[model samples]
Target: MTREIENAAGIPVVQIATIVPIMLTVGANRIVPGVAIPHPTGSPELGKAGDKATRRELLLRAFKAMETEITYQTVFE
Candidate 1:
C-alpha cells in the first residue's frame, strides 16, 4: 500500500479521505478529513467559493499535520 511504502521510506505522509475512521483503522498516521468519497477535496453542493475554501482549509490542516511529529496515528479535521 502507499501508506506502507511511505512509512517504510520514512516519508511524512498526509492522507486525505472521506472515511477517517477507516483510515485510522488501517494505521494511517496523518489523515485529513475529506468532504466525501467522490469529492475528497471539494464538495459540489458547497459551490465554487465554499468548495475552494474547504479545500484550502483541508490542505492547510494537512500541512500542519505534516509539520507536527507524532508517535501514533493522527486525524486532522
Candidate 2:
C-alpha cells in the first residue's frame, strides 16, 4: 500500500527534502532540501562561497516546493 499523511489531502504541497551531503557526493547536487552541501541549514557560517551558493540555489528550490501543484515523489539516484 502507499503511504498517507494525516492532512495530506488538505495540504497541497511545500518544501523539498534530500539526503544532504550524501546526495551531493552522489552526483545529486541539483536536488533541493532544507540544507545544503558542507553545511546544512541553520549553520552560522552561511557567508562562504560554497555555503552561499548552496543556500541561495538549494534553499530557494526548497521554498519553491511550497507553491508546487501536487504532492509527488521526486527521488534521486
Deviating ranges (above 4 Å) for candidate 2: 1-38, 41-47, 75-77
Tens digit per residue, CA lDDT, model 2, 1-77: 01223144544233234454554454332335654334455344655775667556655665564444433443322
Q: What 10-residue stretch in candidate 1 is worst by lDDT?
A: 1-10
Whole-model lDDT, model 1? 0.87
Candidate No. with top lDDT: 1
RMSD for all candidates, in order, please: 1.3, 7.4
Error of 1 at 57 (Å): 0.6
Clashes (backbone N, CA, C under 3 Å), per candidate, total 0, 1
lDDT (Cα, tens digit) per residue for candidate 1, span 1-77: 64796779989889999888898888788988898899999977989999999888989999999999888888776
Stretches > 4 Å off in candidate 1:
none
lDDT of 1 at 63: 95
